[model samples]
Target: MLLATSNHLGHDIRSEKYNVRGTKYRTKHFLEFCIFLFFIYEIEDNLIQNTR
Candidate 1:
């Protein structure tokens, strides 16, 4: 889910950046991406613990 969310967020960032509106959407997309990345890291940590 994290990977999928990252892909979606990347597409949103690209679309928002190219839009004629402004940087508002771009900033939102970037923040969302960061949050998703953190989620991915947490999942990885859990997986590592389970493997031990």
Candidate 2:
């Protein structure tokens, strides 16, 4: 599921950020977080359609 995948990605991002603490890593994680947000939006849309 998207939620599970996002949770896994979040765990990886947190662990990697702590392990490295580099600007490049921070930017990469930021971008990934943006993509995760987009996916959340998509999931919401799907749920709305299902309810309708």
**Candidate 1, which segments miss by more than 4 Å at Cα?**
1-21
Model 1: worst 10 consecutive residues (lDDT sum):
16-25
lDDT of 2: 0.94
* Candidate lDDT (C-alpha), each: 0.91, 0.94
What's every prediction's RMSD, in angstroms? Answer: 17.1, 17.8
Best by lDDT: 2
Candidate 2 wrong stretches, greater than 4 Å:
1-21
lDDT of 1 at 19: 86
lDDT of 2 by residue, 1-52 (tens): 9999999999999988887768778899999999999999999999999999
Candidate 1 lDDT at 37 equals 99
Estimate the TM-score of every prediction: 0.57, 0.55
Q: Looking at candidate 1, what is the lDDT of residue 16?
A: 78
> What is the RMSD of candidate 2?
17.8
TM-score of 1: 0.57
TM accuracy, model 2: 0.55
